[model samples]
Target: MAKVQFNDVSFSYGDKKIIQNLSLEVNDGEIMGVIGPSGCGKTTLIRLLCGFIKPETGSIFIGETCVFDAKKRINIPPERRNIGVVFQDYAVWPHLTVLENVKYPLKKKRMDKKQMQEIAMNALKQVQMETYANHLPSQLSGGQQQRVAIARALVSSKELIVLDEPITNLDLKLRQEMLKEIREIQKTIGTTIVYISHDQEASLELCDRLAIMDQQGNIRQLGNDYDIVMKPKDRYIFEFVGISNFVDVVAKEDGVYINAQNGLVKLDDKSVLENPTKAYQLAFRPMDAVFDNESPIKGKVVTETFLGNITNYFIQLGDKQIRLQQSALDVMKYGKAKEGQEVGLKFVRKFYYEKEEA
Candidate 1:
């Protein structure tokens, strides 16, 4: 399998800069997910890697080969790069049978029919589509069609594959099944994958490592799911990673305090405040906050939603509303808080950030 590397990569579209001085590496035999909001250069990054578009500045390497170098003026074409691509649309030819679709990539090598069939069948087997080899894509489900696309990508013995929102078109159940299938196939073949998506849940569940990009086309953070979620580098990363609540708080000589519905409530930890005189935001995940009757911080329950496994609560503290989540088991034990109920809040995990501008 090949490792992909981008060194000081910068790309622009006319006057608009999409990426700037971005450097990231995808290790061999690992699923590296690049996730961000829409128009965050995720697609542009993939296009640059696949040689569809050249970067304004920087070098790209696949394994040991320098596929692109601005200074050296070396660029290997996409076909020669031996990189497989599975797009969001499945890209399976509707007219062709599953086996034919898988064999299509091998045809350019001028292989004999028997050898091509053998390789194609092997690829289909890897994706568990061998039984439906003769079925046309129109006859297959969306998930099945996606498998055909993946098999086609793998048919040419491609060690590196790029999946661009591959499961976005599938239903929720199909997405989960496809994710499991992909992880299994990766383990079986050890292909280095570069997964591009805006879905935080999918990327967190599938990727070995994640690269978070911002709208400014910068790599904000790169790490595992746990680190990126629990130890976010900044407020942007925290907010992007999951459902987050940010409450405005003022740092005083006594301690950091939030303007609760009752009055000012002192935070337990004063060390998190960066400046004693400035206002900051206390950011935490919905799951990290709990209702505690003894805590001084108070909020009125604006709404409570039972979302299957968890009970979601929107608590109004002063003028700001923040979300909190409780497990169904906890709700069963302690009973659900009613609307308009004034509840005490205790934050289990929180981070401080400069208050956002109005």
Candidate 2:
């Protein structure tokens, strides 16, 4: 499989720039997921790689082949690039049967019927839809149709597959199933798949590496799921990823000054206060919030959700809602802490984000 690289890639519509001089590499055989808010240029990035829109002032390369280099004014046609793309809508032709849809790629080449069927059947079975070869796209369910689309893409033996929001339209169960199948197929083929999505859960489960594209069209951070979730680079990331707990505190030279009911209790973590925006919000997962018996700071448990092995509790800690997720076995109680109970609150490992802009 070939590695995809964007060298100082920039794209614009007339005067306004959608993507700046952003550059990154999708390692060979790695499923690099592109995630960000809507209109953050995720789709635009795909178009550039697919050779739909040539970079305005940079180059895009597929394993050393400069497909688009604005300096040289090179523009390769989309069809000639030989990149496989599976869009969100499951683009299967309604007029064709499942076998015809999967075998369409081989039709262009002079492959014999047996060879074509071999490729199509192997791909179909890989997606677990070989029995539906005679079925039309309309007859199959949405998930099944998407599998057909995947099979069609695989039948060509293309190394790089660009999937743009491939699972957004499916129901919950099917979405999960299709995600599993897609990951398996990618692993089985060892193809470099660029899976694009706005959802974090999907990206966390599928991608080996993730690039978070933010507004103003910049790749803010790129790393593993742990970096994206636990150590967000900024406040925009804390909100984008749906993190549960947030504490707005000011940095006093000594420590973080969080306003408590009795007074502003300073929880010392001097190392994290080194940044210029030291007056930051600590964004932690609900699971990170702890209930300590000896702690002086307290919060009333506003609500509780008993989820078998773990329980989720939302505590009213001063003016903010500090959601806590803990293992059911760790706690002795199941019911909500009585109103105004003042359950002791302790800050566990907190996620530090640049303070929110007023």
Off by over 4 Å in 2: 275-279, 332-340
lDDT of 1 by residue, 1-358 (tens): 9999999999999999999999999999999999988888988998899899999899999999999999999999988888888876546998999998998989899999999989999889988889999999999988888888988888755689888875355788887787888898899889998888767888899999999999999999999989998899998998899998888887887778898998888988757576666668889988888888888999999999988899999999978999999997677655689999999888889999987888
* lDDT comparing candidate 2 with the true structure: 0.80
Point out where model 1 deviates above 4 Å.
166-168, 332-335
Query: Each model's TM-score?
Result: 0.95, 0.92
lDDT at 309 for candidate 1? 91
Compose the digit string of candidate 2's lDDT tens values, residues 273-308: 667554677677776667776677767777877888
Question: Clashes in model 2: which pairs?
Answer: 286-325
All predictions: root-mean-square deviation over Cα?
A: 1.7, 2.4
Candidate whose lDDT is highest? 1
